[model samples]
Target: MKIGLYFGTFNPVHVGHLIIANHFAEYSDLDKIWMVITPHNPFKKKKTLLDNHHRYQLVLEAVEEYPAIEASTIEFNLPQPNYTSNTLAHLKEKYPQHEFCLIMGEDNLRTLHKWKNYEVILKHHDIYVYPRIADSEDQTQHELLNNERIHIIEAPVVEISSTAIRKAIKAGKNCRPLLPQSVWRYIDEMNFYK
Candidate 1:
């Protein structure tokens, strides 16, 4: 199987994430798009993040209707400050028959050099990059952007962010439009981010 691994904290799965995953599943050569729920991202702050299992369950709820999309808790059992390169290596060893591709936003591509063993990741896996509103299209200026393994996908942009959603919920505003119905309902029932 050819899988596109989309790694994120998710915090709470939002519609914007679903849209990107859906686009990859429908348009890309990927057989499935696995939403790898990172319990702790090396580059991000952990204080604001929701519990790993709760976040994973939210992702599972959000993508349940999509056959090609799956929520994965693979990193939960791994070591803290999950590194993409290490996770990729582990996945490759566990599933030798599967070909894995990295799915990320253009913003991440800008800082790829800062990642541990980034050269190995770049050389071994194909990276599918979607444009982010905050990122410039002229990323070709970056030396690593010239790699043939990096593919730029023109998927629809959804400006909604998980941070904004949390803020809206905290302020007693409805953020249903920014998230999947099931996810919003789950948040509402559990009173998350408040």
Candidate 2:
């Protein structure tokens, strides 16, 4: 089976996330999409993120209805400050039979060169890139585009972000429409981001 690994902190899984993952499942050749929840991202500050377990739970609720998409907590057990290259290596060892691919947005594609062992990753697995509205002016053309493994998918450009959702919740705004019903209820009941 060809599985696409969609990595994210999922501060709280929202509708935008579901749309993108679903789009990959429906639009790409990927047989399954794993929403890999990272315990800690090297680039993100922890203070704004919910606990790893809570984020995992939110993902579980967010994706439970979709058969092709599943929530994954694999990174939760690995050593802290998760790196995509390391996670991919561990996944290959754990599930050798299945073919794994990376799913990312256009914005992430811009900075792929800076990632640890990015060259190795590009050489080994296919990368499925989706459209993302860039928040800043980054005009450099990624040389990685020359690689045969990078497939640019014509998916919808989702502008919603987890950061905006968290800020809205903290401000006492009802952002339920931006999230899955179950995820919204879970966040509301747990009083997260308040």
Candidate 3:
């Protein structure tokens, strides 16, 4: 089985996330797109992050309908400031039966050089990059993605972002549109990240 690892904090899962995961699963050669709920990303700030368990649960609620879009918390058991290479290596060892590919945005692709052991990541695994609207500034990166294993997929641009959703929730504004109905209800009921 071929699986695409779609890693993200998913501060609160939304329609945009589901759209991309479904798009990849339905359109790509990948049999399933596991929404890997990254516990921590070295590049991003930790201040705004919700508890890892909450974030993971939100992803599960958002992707519950699609068996191919299940949530994974493998990173939760890894070290802090989780590195992609480390997670990938661990996953490969654990699930040797399944082929693991990467699913990321073009923005991440441009910054891939900064990641720990990026060379290994590029050399060992196949990548499926979805173009982000912001990456339009550098169209060349889309054409000149360094790795031969990389594939640039034209996924629907869902402008929704977790940053915007967090800001809205922090301000006591409604976050209905930015998140799934179940997630929104769960957040409200639990008062998460408040």
lDDT of 2 by residue, 1-194 (tens): 99999999999888999999999999999999999998888998988888888999999999998999999999988888899999999999999999999999988999988899998998899999998777774544356776899999999888898999999998999898999999999999999999
User: Which numbered prediction scores highest in lDDT against the true structure?
Assistant: 2
Write model 1 residue lDDT over 53-82, tens digit each, in one string: 899999999999999999999898888888
Candidate 2 — which residues are off by over 4 angstroms?
135-140
Superposed on all Cα atoms, the candidates' RMSDs to the truth, in angstroms, are: 1.4, 1.4, 1.8
What local distance difference test score does each model get?
0.90, 0.91, 0.87
Worst 10 residues of 3 by lDDT: 135-144
* lDDT pick, better of 2 and 3: 2
If the candidates were sorted by their TM-score against the true structure, best first, what order would they fall in?
2, 1, 3
Among residues 3 or more apart in sequence or in different chains, the pairs in candidate 3 whose N, CA or C atoms overlap within 3 Å are none
lDDT of 1 at 169: 92
Return the clash pairs for model 2, or none: none
Model 2 score (lDDT): 0.91
